[model samples]
Target: MSASLAPECNEVKERYDSCFLKWYSEKFLRGTARSDECDPLFKQYEQCLSKALKAKGIDNMLKEAREDNRENDAEHMRPKR
Candidate 1:
């Protein structure tokens, strides 16, 4: 329904979003989904998105965001004892 981060990947993203929503609501929510029905569509969208992120030089940012940060978690956020 919304535009993708990469305009070029919008169509693929839309297809993946639609299939994912349908599968999630009609099958997953109802406990009838044998597996994700949108895997292929999602994969296609992911590929397009990856290329776009790399083109825009934000792939590393995303990679960093996805990494676990517990080891480097800020002590300032911890409650004082």
Candidate 2:
């Protein structure tokens, strides 16, 4: 079965996407000036993303999902309640 079709793989993919979105929002997306302050967090995010994608070989798909999440976050700050 494809990685996306596996429950565990799908969950890891979702978690990675969420991690990237949260990092992007806090570091770049939000109208804040870029600074070294967020570098550590970004590094951690990159590590996590790498690990997740390595497990499933779906880095490109995860990246696209992260972009979509960012756009959605920009449109609506708080996730639906």
Candidate 3:
């Protein structure tokens, strides 16, 4: 885990990061972008982070970052015409 912004989520982030790195190497690098493998763990980590962010009154920052991420992903995934 790369040091979570919210200290409270550090442990959750570490677990999720480990799962993600394993999945990334075994699945993603092997030619798949599937997320089902880590969906539950990711959701758990997200929940932890969300609570921390909300508590610190930084949920809006989190929302903006999520929006930016979604937009970037969408742009990259869009069909080239």
Local accuracy of candidate 2 as per-residue lDDT tens digits, 1-81: 123444444545555566556666786677664554545555655565577676777877878899879967787896777
Any idea what lDDT model 3 has?
0.84
lDDT tens string, model 3, 1-81?
489988878888898899889988888989877556888888988998888778888988878898779878988898898
Best by lDDT: 1
| Per-prediction TM-score | 0.77, 0.32, 0.71
User: Roughly what TM-score does model 1 have, to 2 decimal places?
Assistant: 0.77
Rank by TM-score (best first) = 1, 3, 2
What digit string (tens of lDDT, one per residue) describes model 1 on residues 1-81? 899989989999999989988998999999999977799999999999999889999988877775757555675567789
* lDDT of all predictions: 0.87, 0.63, 0.84
In candidate 3 the C-alpha lDDT for residue 45 amounts to: 87
lDDT at 68 for candidate 3? Answer: 75
lDDT of 1: 0.87
Listing every candidate in turn, what is its Cα RMSD in Å to the true structure after a full C-alpha superposition? 6.5, 9.8, 3.0
